[model samples]
Target chain A: MERSTIDLWVGIFVALGVAALLGLAMKVGNLTTSNIGATYTVTANFENIGGLKPRAPVKSAGVVVGRVSEIKFDATTFEAVVSLSVDKRYVFPKDTFASIFTAGLLGEQYIGLEAGGDDAKLQNGDKIIKTQDAVVLEKMISQFLYNKAAETPKAPETSGSTSSVVDALGANPLDNTTVNTTINTLDNKGKTDIAQPVAP
Target chain B: MIRSKLLTSAIRTLRNIGSRFTERIWRMGAGARLFGLIVVSSGECLRRPRLVVREVYFTGVMSLIIILVSAFFVGMVLGLQGYNTLQTYGSSEAIGVLVALSLVRELGPVITALLFAGRAGTAITAEIGLMKATEQLSAMEMMAVSPIARVLAPRFWAGVIAMPILAALFCMVGVLGGYLVAVPLIGVDAGAFWSQMQASVDWQHDILNGMFKSVVFGVACTIIAIFEGYDAPPTAEGVSRATTRTVVTSSLVVLGLDFILTSFMINI
Candidate 1:
């Protein structure tokens, strides 16, 4: 190939490559969405962050206002200290509630900020005190089971008059007592089974 | 007598293995020295921009068609397969994330490097090897010309410049192919497909890491090709063997380096 022809092709090749890179950055990557300008850093402590990663979105009212910049474990408090870089354009009250929330049933976690009624605005490096930790599925399921077990034995006791009615009608008073006793024992067993795993 | 013969054979095999191992180590040292020389004399390639441009034209522009075509096919296949699997979980929208992440993080750089090794790398080895066989390198030396500066540096710089661009093109094209299959063919929600991809694929993590990997692969592939050529015996058979070695060595090095780079780059 001639010198000019080779140069022209190389030029075209380089241009195409640059264009492709630009396209990737703009369309396929998070450059457009996560480019929150002029960010101010704030930190919040959480008991558990679950799967919340650094660079996860920090949103207010479903709009991304910042991103989680750093996640450090506070050894003294045994809590996760998460630093969020919120866009300077948006400000929160000092008492803003920062809660880790999942987008869907099985999705990545992000921080959601709910503004609180405070006279003073939050400054950079200020810690948000009212923070909610990520909800672990195992804990939630165990809690539900515990509540069910606690409520189960109470149901029969609340309807004690009905059981008494069975006795008044002379329809197997021993059977009624036995059924109530069995249910109470089963409920206690269920409570112990569910509570043991969660105690730690 | 049979037992003594067997012992002799075993000893000969051991000697052969030892010699081959030491030869490999010596070759590695020589390759490293050549790489250093290329870096030192790379100023010539920059000074004469036309030489590098010509080499880029040969290595990069020529290989574009293969890179683009394979990328498109790979993307379409990923889209079809990812959608098939993800839809079963009722998360077909995440097909975009799967396709984009796989292509940007792993496939784009790796597949492009493999193809470049097959195409441009082999060609570089064969051409330089042939020139050596024809005594062109010695002729240049007799005329007080440094072949490393005059010949190898431009090709080295060209490969380095062209590789990341090719990989980027591969990624862009691959994503488009995936989009085509997902949005129009498979009837995925177009908005969800793009939005999910954008949300998951971070620029610094996914894109830049991929670019870095391609640059590393480029250096490795080009150096292996030039080294194999420069070290080959001045014979047709030797040149042919060097060409084969270029493809095999480049592919292995690219894969091994990719694993190391991924381990470092991925944040757990």
Candidate 2:
């Protein structure tokens, strides 16, 4: 057979193969238009959103039921309002409480919906009245420290070198000064209690 | 002293301009040859039926499996990594978007093309170089056969036609990879990943742009390899050099072409 004859067959086979693979990719990429499931929306209000973002998934009983679609601040109440898109099939009781939950340490955050009693199914656009504002761990720890600092009495000016102890450990004593300044700044900015050591 | 300094400056400027002009001429000559070669070969393909079948097999079908397998694993990794990151923020459901976007935009086409370049590009370069070295190309001329039509046309067309199909296959495998890993391994429901992906991707222009990039890559690789092979040195060492140049030039051109096409398509 001629080399040209061989080339022609090769081309046909390749074209067919390419077509098949494309079909497979569309299937795998979930690219077909009909596959997307149903969606429903729920609303919630909080004093501070604290960096909640759209497209964050909303979970109930550890199962992801929907996503946070929008967040806007209500001017009248100065409250942060969030709209969540839930799967239509997941019905929530009327008194459901919603909280903004952060994933593991250094993780992305999302909304968590807890079922409540009242025997009424929450409709689309129905509000989740009981809501918890986002909690920041760093803020809470700093607040605790600040309160402890206020309760403790200050040391006298004659206090023997606190720097001497750090020097004994072969590290920079000025590090302590920097740390103290940072703590002072955090206390000032947050208005929360900063933990301080009590002098005997 | 002043005269010498001026002479030195003039020499430097002339050298710079000369080098620039040389590069420009080199590019223009190569481009013209490629265009002429494509026109000649494509015309031959239209005139004859046998060449088309060979091209379909060599350029298209021969490469199908590799593209599909590579695409699948790439997709799987995308899903796993994306899900982990999103999991941290409780956005694990967006794994679909991550997998789909990456495959469509960058990974699928580039990887498929590179693999094709390695398989088809190397073989074509070797065949042409061997033919040239053995004087078979000259013999074809004696027999009244236009080597460009008989040889170069089929290879060029193969590259042009095969690349997109391979890329599409690669993309499909990748998406499947993502689904398997995300849904079963990572616990994302199959419905959610599929749904999110469908909502995020816009097929019309985006798919067109990606396939267009693949076509460009295919043409560039084929032309570069053929050019090097056709002009290959007479010795065994010459053939080796031709092969190396073909691979290096094809890979670089593919990447460079990708950047240019992507920037033009996205306006970024």
Q: What's each prediction's TM-score?
A: 0.89, 0.59
Q: Which ranges in model 1 have alpha carbons more than 4 Å from their true place?
A: A1-3, A154-200
Supply the TM-score for candidate 1: 0.89
Cα lDDT for residue B42, candidate 2: 76
Residue B137's lDDT within candidate 2 is 94
Best by DockQ: 1
Give lDDT: candidate 1, residue A4. 83
lDDT of 2 by residue, B1-268 (tens): 9999999999999999999999768865975677686675578788775676666677677777777777888988898889879899788988988987888778877887788878888878888999999999999999999888888888787778778777776777687788899888878987877776765664644565667778788778778777777878877899988888778877877888888888887732
Model 2 residue B102 distance off true place after TM-score fit, in angstroms: 0.8
Worst 10 residues of 1 chain B by lDDT: B42-51
Query: Which lDDT tens digits does candidate 1 get at residues A1-200?
Result: 34587788899999999999999999999898888789899999999999999988999999999999999999999999999999999989998999999998987899999999998999998999999999999999766655554544333433565454333334333567889999999999999998786654
Q: Compute DockQ for each candidate against the true complex.
A: 0.72, 0.21
